[model samples]
Target: MDYFIIVITSAAGLYFHWWLYVRIKRWMDRDLALSLAGADADKRALMLQRLGEAQASGIKRGDLPAWLARAAGEYAPPRD
Candidate 1:
């Protein structure tokens, strides 16, 4: 019975963390998208730099915080 309770609590904690991560990711995506889409060149540049850093960290473009599935027109292939 003790083991069962421990298992249940562990599972609940893991689920909570996963749920929090998803919510934060969604918020980040929304903010990043807005920043990139704005007319302010400075803000756009900043966001682009952030995107570059994320790429350097081995994160895919599709996984970037500002990634938009339906908005592919903005991204360009990286120059080597």
Candidate 2:
């Protein structure tokens, strides 16, 4: 039926998308990119500290408000 076809297609789409993400993530990890961004030692260390604090704050990413959620989209580049 239509629903069954949709489910299968959606699953296939998600699998392929995740596969691509994993491949590219291994190619260039986020933290490594951040470290290589030409920042000085003090700035880099401070940023890393803030990143750790953010992680420790336990604010789930999904819980971000809509405005902030859209801002997060800037982290990833558009797919080629």
Candidate 3:
């Protein structure tokens, strides 16, 4: 009886862990897609234009947050 209980509990725990992992993976994929989409041409152009104006107004690169810097670095121009 005890052995059966342990086996059942272990199976349940593994299933729960797998379920959580799948859910987290799906959420991460969705967020990554959204991030990449935001780096598309229209979005990048808008951001670059804004940044240019900001720079002209004396908003230095060092003043921007690390996340913005990372995003700008990772952003790729959309391909045809």
Candidate 4:
């Protein structure tokens, strides 16, 4: 009985953790989408270019522009 209780508790904890993670991830994704939606096409392109350059040159996050810094925290790149 004790073993069964422990198993159930472990499963419940795992499920709760997974649910929380998914909810948070979805919220973040939505927030990023909204942020990027407010930007013009030119700004979006520039931001993407900046991210690419940063990745290529191994630039740190602190070196990014303010807009990008904000966007990076929420938004993901569009699908190619």
How many residue pairs collide in each prediction? 0, 0, 0, 0
* Candidate 1 local lDDT, 16-72, one digit each (tens): 999999899756755775565577565555565655556467766466743532233
Each prediction's Cα RMSD? 9.7, 12.1, 11.8, 8.0
Query: Whose TM-score is greatest here?
Result: 1
lDDT, residue 55, model 1: 49
The sequence of per-residue lDDT tens digits that candidate 4 reaches over residues 11-72 is 99999999999899556544543465456665556556655655577654444445456655
lDDT of each: 0.63, 0.52, 0.59, 0.62
Model 2 Cα shift for residue 72 (angstroms): 31
Candidate 4 wrongly placed segments (more than 4 Å): 39-80
Model 2: residues >4 Å from true position, as ranges? Answer: 29-80
Model 1: lDDT of residue 3: 100
Query: What TM-score would each prediction reach against the true structure?
Result: 0.48, 0.36, 0.46, 0.47
**Where does the lowest 10-residue lDDT sum fall in candidate 1?**
65-74
Stretches of candidate 3 above 4 Å error? 39-80
| Highest lDDT model number | 1
- Candidate 3 lDDT over 8-43, as tens digits, reads 999999999999998995565344434544746575
Model 1: runs farther than 4 Å from truth?
39-80
Compared with the true structure, model 3 gives a TM-score of 0.46
